[model samples]
Target: MHAPALALGALFSATAAIAHLACIAIGAPAYRVMGAGERMARAAQAGRLQPALVTLAVAAMLSAWAGYAVSGAGVVGPWPFTRPALVLITVLYLARGLAFALLKPLFPGNSATFWWISSGLCLLIGLVHLYGLLAAP
Candidate 1:
């Protein structure tokens, strides 16, 4: 059970990271061509992808938490930073997702540095979770 959970967590984290990176890359071109207003309009019109991405992001965070909980239970010493860091990362991911959803309208254009930076952060957080999984017992 533990092994499977860890594997699943790693998989989720990696997938989330990759997906966000892709979004940032692809969205860049879209922003360049259409401008933020058009891009936001497209996102609003399409509807499906935004919600799906949000769902996946949330799932990734949840899986990371589950993995940490399982692995932490087995350890004897205090994992002072690991658990809190996981929580913080999860919050960051969630906050970014929410911002993307709500502020999609204000996105400015494909050149939006904010989007790129946020996406990169998402990938970094995912990598952090992956590192945690590797370090776990």
Candidate 2:
């Protein structure tokens, strides 16, 4: 079942989810440091709920992705559409990583540092997922 690679992918996703949650708890500076964009940071500083809410949603999604990965690894009970979910997650991460340069224009306010770091992390996670898929019986 390619347990190792899938487990690694799950770990990465879980870590990312934790990071997103941390950004919300740590407030504006955390948002800025995480390359969440100045708008989000400003909104956080102004005590608005939008930034936290959005970050929470992202964290939840990442957590779900992690669950899927773990399920594929057989570390957890099988989830509905596990194979398809893994495929979509892998594709999304790879695309986001590979297209960071192109995506920069769409998220103009995000720092270059953010795009580069996040893209690299995403690419690594995607590769792990791909390896797991390829190794599956």
Candidate 3:
């Protein structure tokens, strides 16, 4: 229940939710913004983006849940589940960051610079969440 944890979680979740929603609104065009190529965009336009966008939206909500949990809101649980969920969230983020950072093979269409920057940002986000969780009282 720390201020920094709450703030960071709120900020990250809000931005993530908004970004994912925007991507849903824009459909395939958003893929270009995400560093995906025209082919990927076309694929997304062909109806592949819906599922991914929805999943991302859910992930954003989960990030928000992490914020709430750390803020002592009692939104998801009693300790057993809450603590484990928080830990999972931290690991999830770290995994995402590393995969994006070192495993550029995930998005072949994306540019190296784009992957590096995005991955670095993801790593930073993960670290922030980790810090918030660890600092939680």
What TM-score would each prediction reach against the true structure? 0.32, 0.97, 0.70
As a whole number from 0 to 100, the lDDT of residue 14 in candidate 2 is 100
* lDDT, candidate 2, 24-129, per-residue tens: 9999999999998999899999999999999999999999999999999999899999999999999999998899989899988899899999999999999999
User: Against the true structure, candidate 3 has what lDDT?
Assistant: 0.64
Q: Residue 8: error of model 3 in Å?
A: 1.2
Worst 10 residues of 2 by lDDT: 101-110
lDDT of 1 by residue, 81-119 (tens): 656655565566556644664665554454456566656
On a 0 to 100 scale, what is the lDDT of residue 132 in model 1?
52
lDDT of each: 0.51, 0.96, 0.64
Q: What RMSD does each model have against the real structure?
A: 11.7, 0.7, 3.5
Model 1 alpha-carbon miss at residue 128, Å: 16
lDDT leaderboard ranking: 2, 3, 1
lDDT of 2: 0.96
Q: In model 2, how many backbone clashes occur?
A: 0
Q: How far does residue 24 in candidate 2 sit from its true spot (Å)?
A: 0.6
Best by lDDT: 2
Highest TM-score model number: 2
